[model samples]
Target: MKKNYYYIAILAFVFVFSSCKKMLEEEAENFVSPSQFYKNEAQCVAALNGCHNPLTSIFNQGLILANEGVTDLAFLNNQNNETRFELSPANPGMGKGLWTSAYQGIMYCNAAIQGIKGAPIAENRKPALIAEAVVLRALYYYVLTSTFGDVPFYTDDVANLATLEKVNALGRMSASDTRKFLIAELKAYVDALPKLRTSEVPNNRISSSMANVLIAKLAMWEKDYGTALAALNEVKTIYGALAQYPLEDTYFRNKNKPESIFEVQYTWSVSGLKKTTQVACYFTPPRTANTSTYNGINIPELGDKANPFTSVSPSAYFMSLYHVWDPRRNIILAYTYNGQNFTRPQSGNGTGKPWMGAKFWCPGMDNLADGNNQKVFRYADVLLLMAECANELDDVALAMSSINEVKRRASQASSASINLELTSYPGKVEFFREVREERARELMGEYGRKWDLVRWGIWYESIMNTVANEFVDIKQNVRPYHEYYPIPDNEILRSDGKLHNNAYK
Candidate 1:
């Protein structure tokens, strides 16, 4: 994987992207100031690519922790403060890293959008490039608002130190207003974006499909089902039938496949440029630190030698949701590796737990430089979201049809699985409950579980329903305010008394 790095000279937005290909590789090529850059199409493209850097930075751990680590579907075995519900406004744990990373990406997007608009590029090329930056900006905001209830919001690039300080000192915006603003912002550029999948794009970059996915997601937060369904319809048209793309091919086994709407690109290399992630380390089975052996037994499925973080793994409650005949049962959970049985935690403790299935396994991923591209948005998630919207809008038939597509694929038509027939649950409330559980069974270990429950106004109560003894601390310490992590305390200090911390129990 050969990569070239171009240097863009914005003080706040100094990151590297490939000069030849689509990968966001970081290196120094030339040091051109903001005033002299974005003079051509290539320069404009480089600016847009830089916006992707912050997303890669956060993907390693911040994203996994904030989105999945604390949710009921996954468990962080190391007693992480966030996963244990022990974090606070002062000691925010993963929230601090997420806050810094998301804001940095937003700054890059803000600068790139302003730069691309003024660049002397071809007129026809400007919209797509600017739209990429626009969507990227919205994505960063989405991360911030979803994680923390409210945050300081800005779309324009900072001019100087004085302007930067002013922006930093701004107060928080309401999450509702912020999401509404981002939804309208995306609509302005959705048509300008090409209606294609990320795999069809050169670097698996943002497409019109991705923009619509984000719009639908933000709209779901607002409880606007009509807007969400309309956006998802556009995605359905672009991605085509869901049956053609299988779960095995679309996830960890490959990168940038047909169903990939957006993936954080990663590469592992002993020499040259290496962009990789630690995401796989979390979900992999618990092992001795820096070794693949557990209890002095080597698991070949976890690679010959690797560094496993012993972090997140499937919860007992989550594993209980899958039917025995479901093909996805094995794909999503690893019961045995290489003919050896995995064990549950002895009694109540969470040790010797099973790995998070083949989808997250990275063989020989020593030192946590796993080359697997993290799936951010995919076709399966879009289908489930469509079903949720349809059910909410009183179109039970459309809802059933949409969800059944994913269920049919998981079931593999192996038997007359009663659970596979989502249409059987004709009542709206009953059907919606099925949709929620189906989301857990299908999208588990992926992002947005806590958000899914929160948007439905059930985050606090849902986690409370867990009977798993390993998560006793989570149920004991969780509160209504825990639905949204508090804004990192340092951010409040940086805001010059303008930003306030979220309330605690």
Candidate 2:
């Protein structure tokens, strides 16, 4: 079996950093090599598409996600099992995968910046492309700081293996400092990004509105309530309310919509030299959704026998996140081979099982079918963030309204419709908890939850309580440094024993 490339991406980090300067410099000097790319506009777009390529394949899409999911909240939500990060705390491929993927995202962004910078695009188009690159680079930096407090910063975007290695060698930047840099980059560049996008490119790049969303996010992280609210209001004013889509209509309703600020795209194709959308299909039940070898699932060949470890089954705790009456509960967690709650396109009649994590919306396809996009950021997020920001600012009316907008959409057809539009919000601490619950309910299974808790400075505490109070996992991993993941051991070794242990350790 092959190793997890997500881990390889991080393990390679120290080596990449050490050798990056010489690596890129020593290579051929043309923008992108004639051997591979750099032909024209389409190629440039394709290369940008390539920048988002990593999120599709890492750990075979076994991404339970980070911040709150693996730490304590939902996603895989296991404790005491051998593979459980919540129990074991660290070092496994699972926990490390989160750390690695974000770094790889940064690496990809770096390459795109370098490639586009040297591309021979017209001057007017250049700013738009550059804005995409800047926003992407900043997003990665934001991840770097969020996941591991002090991380190496690389404004010198270059594609050379050596250039990458050199940046990797530099190690980390202060989290507080990096957040400020991310703030400035988005402010300076996000507005120029193209607003028009299709599924193919929509989730693959950032937008002006996405920049505003990012600003709101960073401001919240910085505890700059004033700035955060201001930024969020801008998103509200510019984007208008999230165009209403009944939350229960279909899994794909609001997704891939224009309301999407940013998302990750996946494609399943055979000759995937540029990108591979294999994982989601690999995990899809063979009998249904044209995933079977016999069905000619529109994919490249899987590894003869499939990689089945990637199949998802929710944690018991995850199932408990929703009330028994909550409509989304069954759609998300509990499953049946053939039932209303279970996923569809199940082959082999109703007998074919529908496991958890049908959220990606990329079921059976050929080995290389591009899975539907994953919305990393959206207008709905703005509403939720604004609610939190309003709560922080003590504007109960606005806070409730912000939360209600998301709730109204989420509960459009349900027995409950969260109507905060007219009601007052609870106190700061109370609204804070409500916001967390709303995020968990609305954004469940997405990558945002765990980190949202972390940013609130309540991750470790909440996880500790949730485990002890809810799941009975008295041994849930809780440590100060849990707020910031450890700098991978290999990278720290480069400090020549001078590296201090993370607060958690």
Q: What range of 10 consecutive residues in model 2 has the weakest lDDT sum? A: 20-29
**What are the Cα lDDT values of the candidates?**
0.76, 0.54
lDDT of 1 by residue, 1-505 (tens): 0011112223445434333234554232343466677778877777777777777776666667667766767767566776777878887877788888788778778877888888887888888888999899898888788888788888868646555656765899888999999999899999998788877876677789999999999999999999999999999998877888877775564888999888877877667557777877776766765556753447655565566676576666787788867767666777665556666533246444556777777766766778888877889899999999998998877898899999878766454455575647568888888888898888775677888888888887767776235667776777778888887777777676798863762
lDDT of 2: 0.54
For this target, which candidate reaches the highest lDDT against the unseen true structure? 1
lDDT of 2 by residue, 1-505 (tens): 0124334543543333322221211221223242244445554555555444445544234443444335454333244342243322335334356556666667656655666667777767766776766676676666656666676676764444565456545745677777777887787776676544322343335666767777777777788878778766766666676535445433431346556666554333445422333434423434333243322332233333333333443344555556544555545543532233333425567434335434433533434443444456766677888887777777888888778877665455455543323255457887777777767666765556666777877776765655434344434544555555565554456545444344645
Where model 1 places Cα greater than 4 Å from the true spot, the runs are 1-10, 15-29, 287-301, 338-340, 343-353, 413-419, 467-469
TM-score of each: 0.90, 0.72
